[model samples]
Target: MHPHDKGKDRLRKFVARSEPAHPKLPLVHSTDAYTFTDALEDGNLEPRDCDVFIGEALIYTFYGRPSYRPNMNESATSLDHYLPVCLILKLSFAQDLKRIFPFDTGAFANDYYSTFMHRRMGLGDFALEADLDTPGRVITTFFGSARNYLHAAPDTKTQFDPAQFEARSYAALIDAKNSNAMDSRGSGIEIQIADPISISNWVEAAVVPSTFVQSETGDALRRLNIEILPYNVHSRMKPNEYMSTVTDACLTYYAQKGML
Candidate 1:
Protein backbone atom coordinates (compact mmCIF):
# COMPACT_ATOMS: atom_id res chain seq x y z
CA MET A 1 0.00 0.00 0.00
CA HIS A 2 1.08 3.60 -0.59
CA PRO A 3 2.36 5.41 2.51
CA HIS A 4 -0.57 7.85 2.53
CA ASP A 5 -3.07 5.00 2.14
CA LYS A 6 -1.38 3.05 4.90
CA GLY A 7 -1.59 6.01 7.26
CA LYS A 8 -5.27 6.57 6.45
CA ASP A 9 -6.02 2.89 6.98
CA ARG A 10 -4.32 2.90 10.37
CA LEU A 11 -6.17 6.03 11.47
CA ARG A 12 -9.50 4.53 10.47
CA LYS A 13 -8.81 1.41 12.48
CA PHE A 14 -7.81 3.50 15.49
CA VAL A 15 -11.10 5.41 15.43
CA ALA A 16 -13.10 2.22 15.04
CA ARG A 17 -11.46 0.52 18.00
CA SER A 18 -11.96 3.65 20.09
CA GLU A 19 -15.70 3.91 19.54
CA PRO A 20 -18.22 3.08 22.25
CA ALA A 21 -19.86 -0.36 22.06
CA HIS A 22 -23.10 0.92 20.63
CA PRO A 23 -22.99 1.36 16.88
CA LYS A 24 -25.30 4.39 16.95
CA LEU A 25 -24.33 6.38 20.04
CA PRO A 26 -25.32 10.02 19.60
CA LEU A 27 -23.20 13.06 20.36
CA VAL A 28 -24.81 15.79 22.44
CA HIS A 29 -24.58 19.51 21.65
CA SER A 30 -26.15 21.72 24.32
CA THR A 31 -27.89 24.94 23.34
CA ASP A 32 -30.68 27.31 24.29
CA ALA A 33 -34.19 27.21 22.82
CA TYR A 34 -33.74 30.23 20.58
CA THR A 35 -30.58 28.96 18.92
CA PHE A 36 -32.09 25.50 18.46
CA THR A 37 -35.13 27.04 16.81
CA ASP A 38 -32.86 28.96 14.47
CA ALA A 39 -31.02 25.78 13.58
CA LEU A 40 -34.27 23.99 12.89
CA GLU A 41 -35.47 26.79 10.62
CA ASP A 42 -32.16 27.08 8.82
CA GLY A 43 -31.65 23.31 8.63
CA ASN A 44 -28.06 23.68 9.81
CA LEU A 45 -25.95 24.11 12.93
CA GLU A 46 -23.68 27.00 11.99
CA PRO A 47 -20.85 27.73 14.39
CA ARG A 48 -21.03 31.28 15.68
CA ASP A 49 -17.72 33.06 16.21
CA CYS A 50 -18.62 33.84 19.81
CA ASP A 51 -19.37 30.22 20.64
CA VAL A 52 -16.69 28.54 18.56
CA PHE A 53 -14.10 26.52 20.48
CA ILE A 54 -10.89 26.38 18.48
CA GLY A 55 -12.79 27.18 15.28
CA GLU A 56 -15.19 24.22 15.37
CA ALA A 57 -18.52 23.22 16.86
CA LEU A 58 -18.33 21.52 20.28
CA ILE A 59 -20.23 18.40 21.34
CA TYR A 60 -20.07 15.72 24.03
CA THR A 61 -20.28 11.94 24.19
CA PHE A 62 -20.89 9.77 27.23
CA TYR A 63 -19.58 6.51 28.67
CA GLY A 64 -22.63 5.85 30.81
CA ARG A 65 -26.35 5.85 30.08
CA PRO A 66 -27.57 5.91 26.48
CA SER A 67 -30.35 8.46 26.95
CA TYR A 68 -30.03 12.19 26.23
CA ARG A 69 -29.23 14.59 29.09
CA PRO A 70 -28.63 18.30 29.38
CA ASN A 71 -25.04 19.42 30.03
CA MET A 72 -25.45 22.10 32.69
CA ASN A 73 -21.76 22.94 32.47
CA GLU A 74 -22.30 24.42 29.05
CA SER A 75 -23.10 27.77 30.66
CA ALA A 76 -22.68 29.66 33.94
CA THR A 77 -26.38 29.62 34.74
CA SER A 78 -29.06 26.95 34.92
CA LEU A 79 -29.41 25.62 31.40
CA ASP A 80 -33.16 25.17 31.90
CA HIS A 81 -33.52 28.86 32.68
CA TYR A 82 -32.52 29.54 29.14
CA LEU A 83 -34.96 26.89 27.91
CA PRO A 84 -32.04 24.56 27.28
CA VAL A 85 -32.03 21.70 24.79
CA CYS A 86 -29.58 19.21 23.38
CA LEU A 87 -29.00 18.41 19.74
CA ILE A 88 -28.29 14.72 19.25
CA LEU A 89 -25.91 14.01 16.39
CA LYS A 90 -25.31 10.49 15.15
CA LEU A 91 -21.79 9.32 15.97
CA SER A 92 -21.67 7.10 12.91
CA PHE A 93 -22.56 10.03 10.70
CA ALA A 94 -19.98 12.28 12.36
CA GLN A 95 -17.21 9.70 11.93
CA ASP A 96 -18.19 9.21 8.33
CA LEU A 97 -18.07 12.99 7.81
CA LYS A 98 -14.31 12.75 8.56
CA ARG A 99 -14.13 16.31 9.95
CA ILE A 100 -14.79 15.22 13.52
CA PHE A 101 -12.07 14.40 16.09
CA PRO A 102 -12.02 13.64 19.81
CA PHE A 103 -10.05 15.27 22.61
CA ASP A 104 -9.39 13.20 25.73
CA THR A 105 -10.39 16.11 27.97
CA GLY A 106 -12.69 19.07 28.03
CA ALA A 107 -11.04 21.37 25.46
CA PHE A 108 -12.45 24.55 27.05
CA ALA A 109 -10.74 24.02 30.41
CA ASN A 110 -7.96 26.34 31.62
CA ASP A 111 -5.14 23.82 31.18
CA TYR A 112 -2.32 25.80 29.54
CA TYR A 113 -0.80 22.94 27.58
CA SER A 114 -4.19 21.88 26.23
CA THR A 115 -4.93 25.44 25.18
CA PHE A 116 -1.61 25.69 23.36
CA MET A 117 -2.21 22.40 21.60
CA HIS A 118 -5.69 23.47 20.53
CA ARG A 119 -4.33 26.67 19.03
CA ARG A 120 -1.44 24.92 17.35
CA MET A 121 -3.43 22.00 16.02
CA GLY A 122 -7.00 22.86 15.16
CA LEU A 123 -9.34 19.83 15.19
CA GLY A 124 -8.70 19.05 11.53
CA ASP A 125 -4.94 19.33 11.86
CA PHE A 126 -4.75 16.44 14.33
CA ALA A 127 -6.24 14.06 11.77
CA LEU A 128 -3.99 15.03 8.88
CA GLU A 129 -2.05 12.26 7.08
CA ALA A 130 1.27 13.57 8.41
CA ASP A 131 -0.05 13.72 11.98
CA LEU A 132 -1.48 10.20 11.68
CA ASP A 133 2.03 8.91 10.95
CA THR A 134 2.70 9.52 14.63
CA PRO A 135 -0.77 9.21 16.15
CA GLY A 136 0.29 9.45 19.78
CA ARG A 137 1.91 12.85 19.13
CA VAL A 138 -1.47 14.14 17.99
CA ILE A 139 -3.88 12.20 20.23
CA THR A 140 -3.86 10.76 23.74
CA THR A 141 -6.77 9.22 25.62
CA PHE A 142 -5.98 9.15 29.31
CA PHE A 143 -6.71 6.37 31.78
CA GLY A 144 -8.28 9.01 34.01
CA SER A 145 -8.68 12.74 33.55
CA ALA A 146 -5.93 14.27 31.44
CA ARG A 147 -5.82 17.00 34.08
CA ASN A 148 -4.07 14.59 36.42
CA TYR A 149 -1.22 14.32 33.94
CA LEU A 150 -1.10 18.04 33.15
CA HIS A 151 -0.96 19.16 36.77
CA ALA A 152 1.82 16.82 37.83
CA ALA A 153 5.19 18.53 38.12
CA PRO A 154 7.81 17.25 35.65
CA ASP A 155 10.51 16.16 38.14
CA THR A 156 8.15 14.62 40.71
CA LYS A 157 5.80 13.07 38.17
CA THR A 158 5.96 10.50 35.44
CA GLN A 159 6.70 12.16 32.13
CA PHE A 160 4.21 11.99 29.27
CA ASP A 161 5.91 10.37 26.30
CA PRO A 162 4.00 11.09 23.11
CA ALA A 163 5.24 7.90 21.47
CA GLN A 164 3.94 5.85 24.41
CA PHE A 165 0.45 7.41 24.52
CA GLU A 166 -2.38 4.98 23.99
CA ALA A 167 -5.23 6.26 21.86
CA ARG A 168 -8.66 4.99 22.97
CA SER A 169 -12.27 5.97 22.52
CA TYR A 170 -13.76 8.18 25.22
CA ALA A 171 -16.12 5.33 25.98
CA ALA A 172 -13.23 3.13 27.06
CA LEU A 173 -13.03 5.14 30.29
CA ILE A 174 -15.83 3.02 31.75
CA ASP A 175 -15.40 -0.64 32.67
CA ALA A 176 -17.29 -3.00 34.97
CA LYS A 177 -14.54 -2.69 37.57
CA ASN A 178 -14.49 1.11 37.66
CA SER A 179 -17.68 2.13 39.41
CA ASN A 180 -16.48 5.68 40.05
CA ALA A 181 -15.80 6.36 36.40
CA MET A 182 -19.08 4.77 35.43
CA ASP A 183 -20.98 6.95 37.93
CA SER A 184 -19.52 10.18 36.59
CA ARG A 185 -21.65 12.47 34.44
CA GLY A 186 -19.48 12.12 31.34
CA SER A 187 -16.00 11.16 30.20
CA GLY A 188 -14.85 14.82 30.10
CA ILE A 189 -14.02 14.27 26.46
CA GLU A 190 -14.84 16.79 23.76
CA ILE A 191 -15.68 16.06 20.14
CA GLN A 192 -15.06 18.86 17.66
CA ILE A 193 -16.74 19.00 14.26
CA ALA A 194 -16.14 21.27 11.30
CA ASP A 195 -18.63 24.11 10.90
CA PRO A 196 -22.01 24.34 9.19
CA ILE A 197 -23.27 20.85 9.92
CA SER A 198 -26.55 20.24 8.17
CA ILE A 199 -29.30 19.54 10.66
CA SER A 200 -31.38 17.51 8.23
CA ASN A 201 -28.41 15.37 7.42
CA TRP A 202 -26.61 15.06 10.78
CA VAL A 203 -29.03 15.54 13.69
CA GLU A 204 -30.83 12.38 14.80
CA ALA A 205 -32.82 13.68 17.76
CA ALA A 206 -33.19 16.46 20.35
CA VAL A 207 -33.70 16.65 24.11
CA VAL A 208 -35.83 19.49 25.48
CA PRO A 209 -36.87 20.37 28.99
CA SER A 210 -40.42 19.30 29.92
CA THR A 211 -41.41 22.97 29.95
CA PHE A 212 -40.90 23.22 26.21
CA VAL A 213 -42.65 20.00 25.33
CA GLN A 214 -45.88 21.86 24.46
CA SER A 215 -44.32 25.11 23.30
CA GLU A 216 -43.88 26.34 19.73
CA THR A 217 -40.36 24.98 19.77
CA GLY A 218 -41.61 21.46 20.38
CA ASP A 219 -43.97 21.78 17.48
CA ALA A 220 -41.10 22.85 15.25
CA LEU A 221 -39.02 19.91 16.42
CA ARG A 222 -41.81 17.51 15.50
CA ARG A 223 -42.18 19.14 12.11
CA LEU A 224 -38.54 18.45 11.43
CA ASN A 225 -38.89 14.78 12.41
CA ILE A 226 -36.31 15.12 15.19
CA GLU A 227 -37.17 12.87 18.12
CA ILE A 228 -37.92 14.91 21.25
CA LEU A 229 -36.58 13.61 24.54
CA PRO A 230 -37.49 15.12 27.88
CA TYR A 231 -34.48 16.00 30.04
CA ASN A 232 -35.98 15.03 33.43
CA VAL A 233 -35.28 11.37 32.73
CA HIS A 234 -31.55 11.77 33.32
CA SER A 235 -30.20 12.77 36.74
CA ARG A 236 -27.29 14.71 35.31
CA MET A 237 -29.60 17.14 33.56
CA LYS A 238 -29.94 19.18 36.73
CA PRO A 239 -27.83 22.33 37.13
CA ASN A 240 -24.52 21.98 38.93
CA GLU A 241 -24.28 23.06 42.56
CA TYR A 242 -22.53 26.38 41.87
CA MET A 243 -25.03 27.35 39.19
CA SER A 244 -28.16 26.75 41.27
CA THR A 245 -28.48 30.36 42.42
CA VAL A 246 -27.73 31.74 38.98
CA THR A 247 -30.23 29.34 37.50
CA ASP A 248 -32.90 30.47 39.96
CA ALA A 249 -32.30 34.08 38.96
CA CYS A 250 -32.64 33.18 35.30
CA LEU A 251 -35.86 31.32 35.98
CA THR A 252 -37.25 34.40 37.71
CA TYR A 253 -36.24 36.64 34.83
CA TYR A 254 -37.88 34.37 32.27
CA ALA A 255 -41.04 33.99 34.36
CA GLN A 256 -41.32 37.76 34.80
CA LYS A 257 -41.14 38.17 31.04
CA GLY A 258 -43.95 35.55 30.74
CA MET A 259 -41.68 33.20 28.81
CA LEU A 260 -42.10 30.33 31.28
Candidate 2:
Protein backbone atom coordinates (compact mmCIF):
# COMPACT_ATOMS: atom_id res chain seq x y z
CA MET A 1 0.00 0.00 0.00
CA HIS A 2 1.08 3.57 -0.56
CA PRO A 3 2.35 5.07 2.71
CA HIS A 4 -0.23 7.85 2.68
CA ASP A 5 -3.15 5.49 2.17
CA LYS A 6 -1.84 3.15 4.85
CA GLY A 7 -1.64 6.01 7.35
CA LYS A 8 -5.17 7.11 6.62
CA ASP A 9 -6.48 3.60 7.24
CA ARG A 10 -4.64 3.40 10.56
CA LEU A 11 -5.99 6.80 11.59
CA ARG A 12 -9.55 5.64 10.80
CA LYS A 13 -9.07 2.60 12.98
CA PHE A 14 -7.75 4.64 15.86
CA VAL A 15 -10.70 6.97 15.75
CA ALA A 16 -13.16 4.09 15.72
CA ARG A 17 -11.62 2.30 18.68
CA SER A 18 -11.84 3.08 22.38
CA GLU A 19 -8.76 3.87 24.41
CA PRO A 20 -8.56 2.44 27.89
CA ALA A 21 -8.65 5.08 30.61
CA HIS A 22 -5.32 6.02 32.13
CA PRO A 23 -5.75 5.12 35.79
CA LYS A 24 -3.66 8.02 37.05
CA LEU A 25 -5.68 10.56 35.11
CA PRO A 26 -8.55 12.01 37.08
CA LEU A 27 -11.86 12.87 35.48
CA VAL A 28 -11.46 16.36 34.04
CA HIS A 29 -14.19 19.01 34.26
CA SER A 30 -14.97 22.17 32.37
CA THR A 31 -13.52 25.62 33.17
CA ASP A 32 -16.74 26.72 34.88
CA ALA A 33 -16.32 23.71 37.16
CA TYR A 34 -12.88 24.73 38.40
CA THR A 35 -11.00 27.36 40.38
CA PHE A 36 -7.32 28.32 40.75
CA THR A 37 -6.38 25.45 43.02
CA ASP A 38 -8.26 23.06 40.77
CA ALA A 39 -5.55 23.66 38.19
CA LEU A 40 -2.87 23.26 40.83
CA GLU A 41 -4.21 19.94 42.17
CA ASP A 42 -4.09 18.76 38.58
CA GLY A 43 -0.27 19.29 38.41
CA ASN A 44 0.06 22.11 35.87
CA LEU A 45 1.12 25.24 37.74
CA GLU A 46 3.74 23.69 39.98
CA PRO A 47 5.66 21.83 37.30
CA ARG A 48 5.47 24.80 34.99
CA ASP A 49 6.71 27.05 37.75
CA CYS A 50 9.62 24.69 38.25
CA ASP A 51 10.26 24.77 34.53
CA VAL A 52 10.52 28.51 34.61
CA PHE A 53 12.63 28.83 37.75
CA ILE A 54 15.03 25.86 37.50
CA GLY A 55 17.38 27.65 35.06
CA GLU A 56 17.99 24.34 33.31
CA ALA A 57 14.65 22.69 32.71
CA LEU A 58 14.46 21.20 29.22
CA ILE A 59 11.27 20.23 27.44
CA TYR A 60 10.77 17.28 25.11
CA THR A 61 7.19 17.68 24.00
CA PHE A 62 5.55 16.10 20.95
CA TYR A 63 3.44 17.77 18.32
CA GLY A 64 2.24 16.88 14.84
CA ARG A 65 4.12 18.27 11.90
CA PRO A 66 1.33 20.72 11.19
CA SER A 67 -0.39 20.99 14.55
CA TYR A 68 -1.19 18.55 17.30
CA ARG A 69 -3.81 19.20 19.96
CA PRO A 70 -3.88 16.91 22.93
CA ASN A 71 -6.90 15.59 24.83
CA MET A 72 -8.50 18.50 26.63
CA ASN A 73 -11.30 18.79 29.14
CA GLU A 74 -13.12 21.86 30.43
CA SER A 75 -10.67 22.28 33.29
CA ALA A 76 -7.81 22.88 30.87
CA THR A 77 -6.50 26.38 30.17
CA SER A 78 -4.50 27.31 27.10
CA LEU A 79 -1.54 27.66 29.45
CA ASP A 80 -1.78 24.18 30.91
CA HIS A 81 -3.39 21.88 28.35
CA TYR A 82 -0.81 19.51 26.92
CA LEU A 83 -0.71 16.19 25.13
CA PRO A 84 -0.05 13.10 27.25
CA VAL A 85 3.48 12.49 25.96
CA CYS A 86 5.06 15.83 26.83
CA LEU A 87 8.25 15.56 28.88
CA ILE A 88 10.20 18.24 30.83
CA LEU A 89 13.64 17.35 32.09
CA LYS A 90 14.29 18.68 35.63
CA LEU A 91 17.83 18.50 37.00
CA SER A 92 19.19 18.65 40.54
CA PHE A 93 20.34 22.24 41.06
CA ALA A 94 22.58 21.45 44.01
CA GLN A 95 24.40 18.27 42.96
CA ASP A 96 24.53 18.46 39.19
CA LEU A 97 24.97 22.21 38.74
CA LYS A 98 28.72 21.86 38.37
CA ARG A 99 28.56 19.21 35.67
CA ILE A 100 25.48 20.55 33.90
CA PHE A 101 26.79 24.10 33.82
CA PRO A 102 30.05 23.01 32.23
CA PHE A 103 29.87 25.94 29.87
CA ASP A 104 31.01 29.10 31.61
CA THR A 105 28.79 32.13 32.17
CA GLY A 106 30.43 33.82 29.15
CA ALA A 107 29.42 31.00 26.80
CA PHE A 108 25.97 30.94 28.36
CA ALA A 109 25.44 34.70 28.08
CA ASN A 110 26.71 34.93 24.50
CA ASP A 111 25.19 31.74 23.13
CA TYR A 112 22.32 30.68 25.39
CA TYR A 113 21.42 32.74 28.45
CA SER A 114 19.37 35.58 27.00
CA THR A 115 17.79 33.40 24.33
CA PHE A 116 16.66 30.70 26.76
CA MET A 117 15.61 33.20 29.40
CA HIS A 118 13.69 35.06 26.74
CA ARG A 119 12.04 32.02 25.22
CA ARG A 120 11.75 29.05 27.60
CA MET A 121 12.15 30.98 30.90
CA GLY A 122 15.26 29.05 31.94
CA LEU A 123 18.97 28.69 31.33
CA GLY A 124 20.94 25.66 30.18
CA ASP A 125 24.66 25.82 29.55
CA PHE A 126 24.39 22.34 28.07
CA ALA A 127 25.23 21.97 24.39
CA LEU A 128 21.94 21.85 22.51
CA GLU A 129 23.66 23.08 19.31
CA ALA A 130 23.95 19.37 18.41
CA ASP A 131 22.59 17.03 21.11
CA LEU A 132 22.17 16.81 24.86
CA ASP A 133 25.63 15.97 26.24
CA THR A 134 25.24 16.96 29.89
CA PRO A 135 24.89 14.28 32.56
CA GLY A 136 22.21 14.39 35.21
CA ARG A 137 19.14 12.50 36.34
CA VAL A 138 16.28 14.24 34.53
CA ILE A 139 12.95 13.84 36.27
CA THR A 140 9.99 14.35 34.00
CA THR A 141 6.36 13.33 33.45
CA PHE A 142 7.48 11.17 30.48
CA PHE A 143 8.65 8.57 32.97
CA GLY A 144 5.00 7.83 33.61
CA SER A 145 3.73 8.24 30.04
CA ALA A 146 6.41 5.96 28.61
CA ARG A 147 5.46 3.19 30.98
CA ASN A 148 1.82 3.46 29.87
CA TYR A 149 2.25 3.89 26.10
CA LEU A 150 0.29 7.12 26.24
CA HIS A 151 -1.99 8.42 23.48
CA ALA A 152 -1.67 11.74 21.69
CA ALA A 153 -4.00 13.37 19.20
CA PRO A 154 -2.69 13.91 15.67
CA ASP A 155 -2.93 17.09 13.65
CA THR A 156 -6.38 17.83 12.29
CA LYS A 157 -5.02 19.66 9.26
CA THR A 158 -3.56 16.46 7.84
CA GLN A 159 -7.04 14.92 7.34
CA PHE A 160 -6.60 13.08 10.61
CA ASP A 161 -9.45 14.04 12.86
CA PRO A 162 -10.03 13.44 16.56
CA ALA A 163 -8.21 10.14 16.76
CA GLN A 164 -5.58 9.30 19.35
CA PHE A 165 -2.35 7.46 18.55
CA GLU A 166 0.21 5.66 20.69
CA ALA A 167 3.32 7.66 21.73
CA ARG A 168 6.57 5.89 22.54
CA SER A 169 9.10 7.01 25.17
CA TYR A 170 12.89 6.84 25.38
CA ALA A 171 15.62 8.31 27.60
CA ALA A 172 19.41 8.37 27.51
CA LEU A 173 21.78 9.45 30.25
CA ILE A 174 25.40 10.29 29.37
CA ASP A 175 27.52 10.45 32.52
CA ALA A 176 30.09 12.73 30.94
CA LYS A 177 29.51 16.41 30.29
CA ASN A 178 30.10 17.63 26.72
CA SER A 179 30.95 14.10 25.56
CA ASN A 180 30.57 13.15 21.89
CA ALA A 181 28.52 10.15 23.03
CA MET A 182 25.59 11.09 20.82
CA ASP A 183 27.72 11.70 17.71
CA SER A 184 27.64 8.00 16.88
CA ARG A 185 23.89 7.46 17.32
CA GLY A 186 22.84 10.88 15.99
CA SER A 187 20.95 12.24 19.02
CA GLY A 188 19.35 8.88 19.94
CA ILE A 189 15.69 9.21 18.80
CA GLU A 190 14.21 10.09 15.45
CA ILE A 191 11.71 12.87 16.24
CA GLN A 192 10.56 13.95 12.82
CA ILE A 193 6.80 13.66 13.37
CA ALA A 194 5.06 13.50 10.02
CA ASP A 195 1.77 11.94 8.98
CA PRO A 196 0.33 10.15 12.01
CA ILE A 197 -0.96 7.35 9.81
CA SER A 198 2.46 5.92 9.04
CA ILE A 199 3.81 6.14 12.58
CA SER A 200 0.76 5.73 14.84
CA ASN A 201 1.15 1.98 15.08
CA TRP A 202 4.90 2.29 15.15
CA VAL A 203 4.65 4.43 18.31
CA GLU A 204 2.67 1.71 20.04
CA ALA A 205 5.39 -0.83 19.38
CA ALA A 206 8.27 1.47 20.39
CA VAL A 207 7.60 1.93 24.10
CA VAL A 208 10.94 2.05 25.88
CA PRO A 209 10.44 3.35 29.41
CA SER A 210 13.09 5.20 31.42
CA THR A 211 13.67 3.54 34.78
CA PHE A 212 13.54 5.48 38.07
CA VAL A 213 15.32 4.79 41.34
CA GLN A 214 16.70 6.61 44.41
CA SER A 215 20.36 6.11 43.63
CA GLU A 216 23.30 8.21 44.91
CA THR A 217 22.89 10.27 41.72
CA GLY A 218 19.81 11.47 43.55
CA ASP A 219 16.16 10.47 43.29
CA ALA A 220 14.46 10.03 39.93
CA LEU A 221 12.49 13.01 38.68
CA ARG A 222 9.30 12.72 40.73
CA ARG A 223 8.24 16.17 41.93
CA LEU A 224 9.06 19.74 41.04
CA ASN A 225 9.74 22.23 43.84
CA ILE A 226 8.58 25.52 42.40
CA GLU A 227 5.37 27.49 42.78
CA ILE A 228 3.77 29.86 40.32
CA LEU A 229 3.32 33.41 41.42
CA PRO A 230 -0.14 35.01 41.35
CA TYR A 231 0.95 37.35 38.57
CA ASN A 232 1.92 34.46 36.31
CA VAL A 233 -1.66 33.27 36.41
CA HIS A 234 -3.48 36.50 35.55
CA SER A 235 -1.00 38.71 33.79
CA ARG A 236 -2.12 41.19 31.16
CA MET A 237 1.38 41.58 29.75
CA LYS A 238 2.34 40.24 26.33
CA PRO A 239 4.59 37.17 26.11
CA ASN A 240 7.89 39.09 26.16
CA GLU A 241 6.62 41.59 28.65
CA TYR A 242 5.28 38.86 30.87
CA MET A 243 8.60 37.04 30.74
CA SER A 244 10.33 40.25 31.72
CA THR A 245 8.01 40.57 34.66
CA VAL A 246 8.73 36.99 35.63
CA THR A 247 12.46 37.49 35.18
CA ASP A 248 12.39 40.52 37.41
CA ALA A 249 10.36 38.66 39.98
CA CYS A 250 12.79 35.75 39.88
CA LEU A 251 15.78 38.05 40.17
CA THR A 252 14.30 39.93 43.09
CA TYR A 253 13.27 36.74 44.84
CA TYR A 254 16.71 35.23 44.46
CA ALA A 255 18.44 38.43 45.57
CA GLN A 256 16.24 38.45 48.64
CA LYS A 257 17.10 34.81 49.23
CA GLY A 258 13.44 33.97 49.88
CA MET A 259 12.74 36.98 52.07
CA LEU A 260 10.26 38.15 49.46
lDDT of each: 0.41, 0.21
Cα-based TM-score, every candidate? 0.48, 0.21
Give each prediction's root-mean-square deviation over alpha carbons. Answer: 11.9, 21.4
Candidate 1 least-lDDT 10 residues? 149-158
- Model 2 lDDT, residue 168, Cα: 11
Candidate 1 residue-wise lDDT, 1-260, digit = tens: 21111222333345444323211223456666667778778877775542324444434332111212234355444444545555656544533232333333333233312313324322332232221212222223233222221221112222333432222222232222334223232222244344577777766567666667787877877776876666442233444332233223323432443433
After superposition, the stretches of candidate 2 with alpha carbons farther than 4 Å from their true spots are 1-228, 232-236, 258-260
Model 1 CA deviation exceeding 4 Å by range: 1-22, 50-81, 90-109, 112-163, 166-189, 232-260
* Candidate achieving the largest TM-score: 1
Model 1 misses residue 254 by how many Å? 32
Per-residue CA lDDT of candidate 2, range 186-216, in tens?
1111111111111111111110111112321
Q: Candidate 2: deviation at residue 136, Å?
A: 14
